[model samples]
Target chain A: MKMAIAKQEVRALSGDEAVAYAVKQSDVDVVAAYPITPQTIIVERFSEYVHNGEVDTEFICVESEHSALTACLAASATGVRTFTASGSAGLALMHEILYVTSGCRAPVVMAIVNRALSAPINIHCDHADSMVERDAGWIQIYVENSQETYDSVIQAFRIAEDPDILLPTMVMLDAFVISHTLESVKVLPDDIVRKFVGTRQIPLVKNHEGKLVPFKLDPENPVTMGPLDLYDYYFEHKRQQEDAMQRASQKIKQIHDEYGEITGRRYGNGLINPYRLEDAEIAAICLGSTAGTAKTVVDQLRAKGVKAGLLRLRAYRPFPAQDVTKVLENVKAIAVMDRSHSFGAYGGPVFHEVRHTLYDAATHPQIVNYVYGLGGRDMPQTLIHEIYKELQKILETKRVKKPVRFIGVRE
Target chain B: MTAKQKGWKELPIAGLCWKPSTEYFTGDWRTFKPMLDEEKCTKCLICYIDCPDVAVKWKPEDEKIEFDYNFCKGCGICANVCPSEAIKMVLE
Candidate 1:
């Protein structure tokens, strides 16, 4: 069912500004954040909104990222929409509470400006910040551009707050590439965004007194959240979280489709957005802004009758294993690009998951991992073409001699 | 008798504990128990104030202080804090 696209205004905004715009229009009740590189602009812009009285959100400037998400978690527990943004070391600081927020079932929406974790203190694009938290039980969405960043941030709130899946969500945009770069983003009017996100519907739970009340920290009817569940019940709660994550894949698709109806813009099923995968003999799988570059490469390869395709992973937490399998089933050779590499591991994080996902398939493609662009390195078009050329060699040879290769790196 | 343990689906989402903490008997974990001597009690209520688990029950109407061992972990804080040394800790 298709609905008419809502009227929108075109604005040149950076990826950070796009997230702020979406949160501002979503009528977020609270925003607690600490300014970090690339992610700082998001809170800076939102703080301006708070100062100008543009929105009624309580903007909290926390001392550290840990306190920022901790405050957001507490605020979200009270049944109000909350938001925060962080990256790199800041995201690392919030690592402990990331699990606590999801375990408490607080639907706090966060924007992660993906940045390289510091060893030499480099502030550049990488997936290490968010990828490390993949098992933290939050719904993770990676966007290709500023426009999708704006659209996904709005969709994230609805997806997280769905009663069937009350998990915290983090929308990731590449640092510098998307966060600092300006692009034309079509933003829905405030009222339309508000109407689309709607209000957070608090589910009812039985209280201590056996009275059914809304699931929130209410003084009138108190309930303990993030309480101690030792051996007697800890495993069951974890299982319940897994259940919600499984439910989130379908919920994300549903919400993405619903948003598409109003905006007339949709990524491929909101899980895995396939670009020219149909009837292609070779394809590459990637995440974040790299997809934008890979798409151009795929188009170029297709022009030369190379039958090359690209599969952009939009949702990573739910993993979208089924969509990935279906999209790359016919392809003979594939490349899994990782902007972040797992030190001393067989391959990057994405490669491990993608390989494990296809282990049970009837016929598996010759899949290889290419760990590239770590610590803000540039992944030019020529490098992506090199990856495809490598895939072509793998297809002809029908064997993977070296399963993991680091591209564009002097090794 | 222990109530039936809830299955994963029946458990509140995210393990929200709506039931009071008293439902779990912490006394079973006690390695030591606090014994009170009513004659040595000075009614200072210091033990009641010091007990972390609120196991030291104080009935102000009758000026009676007693220990509710059911919820007590037998931490011995009350025995340590008792001004009159009315409470003593012994192996349970």
Candidate 2:
């Protein structure tokens, strides 16, 4: 089945600008953000819109990323749509509240310009920032370029605020690669976006007193949020979040399908964005801007009669395990590229999950993990080609010489 | 109780505290209750503004402030805030 790519006016925009425009069009009630590399432009642009009276939004420039998220939590608890953005250390600083936001089920939308986490201190593209928080209970959607960044931000609000899934979501784009790189993007009119996002759905829940009340901080309803729960009920609350994530996987696909009907842009089933994976002997799986690069390599290899394909993991939090198993089951060999390393683990986060997902499959493909593009290092087309060549070797010999290899990094 | 046993029906949706603070009668926790000495009492109403819990209520018939013992924790903040020493914390 072909995706309906919507016809609209194309605007030249960087990924950051695209996200900013989406936030603007979303009619967000509040934006609480702190400036960080790559992520700075997003809140900055939105603040300008707030300043010029282009949109009605409460723009809060907080002292730290922690406060920025705290403000978002407060605003979200008040039953209003809220947004924020950060990267690298900024995201790390807000790590504690990230859990609070989801645990509280605030449904805050955040734009994450993915950047390398610090040791020696670097501000460039890497998945380390978002990958570290993979288990934070937030719905994570990684984007390929400016267009996807724009599209996903709008969809994120719908997905997050869904009654079944009252969870926060982050739209992650590779730092600089997609965040700063300019591309042509078709932006939907503000009214269309406003109608699509609609009003926030704050479900009524029964409290301890057995009264049905709005699940928000309202004076009339008088509900309390973020109370200390010990052994009596904390675990049940976590399970609620888990069930929400499972429901989210299905809801995300549903929202994407409905969104595609209007906008004509769809990511492969809203989980895995696959390119020419059918009848392929070799394949590579990655996320973010690298997928675009890998697809280019796929096209080049296909011209030479090599069966190469690409799988871009659009939704990372849910992991899309079933889709990965179904798509990669037939391939002879596969390379899982990760922009972040898992320290001393067997492989990077994506690699480990991909390998684990394939274990229960009827057919197993020779899988190799390649740790690449750390610290904003360039992932040239040649490196992606080399990975496919390595996959080809594995197919011919039916062996994986190295389970995990560092790509473009000195040993 | 274990979380697994709580079940979906019993789970609190979005962590909303089911019991609003007002619902809990904290008066039982009080070790000392504020006793007003009407003879020495001044009609300043300073105790009304200084009561942390808003437990001090103004009686229209008496034209004096009376504490609502149902919600009062008896922390003695209102007694201390009383300038005329008209109110004092007494053992419950």
Best model number under lDDT: 1
What's the DockQ for every one of the candidates?
0.61, 0.40
For model 1, the docking class works out as medium
Model 1, position A347, has a per-residue lDDT of 99
Error of 1 at A226 (Å): 2.2
Per-residue lDDT value at A401 in model 1? 84
Give candidate 2's root-mean-square deviation (CA, Å): 6.6
- Stretches of candidate 1 exceeding 4 Å from the true structure: B31-92
Writing each residue's lDDT as its tens digit, candidate 1 over A152-260 gives 9999999999988999999999999999999999999999999999999999999877789899999987887777778778999999999999999999999999999
- What does DockQ come to for candidate 2? 0.40
Task: List the global CA lDDT of all models.
Answer: 0.93, 0.90
Chain A TM-score values for every predicted structure, listed in order: 0.99, 0.98
- Please state the i-RMS of candidate 2: 2.2
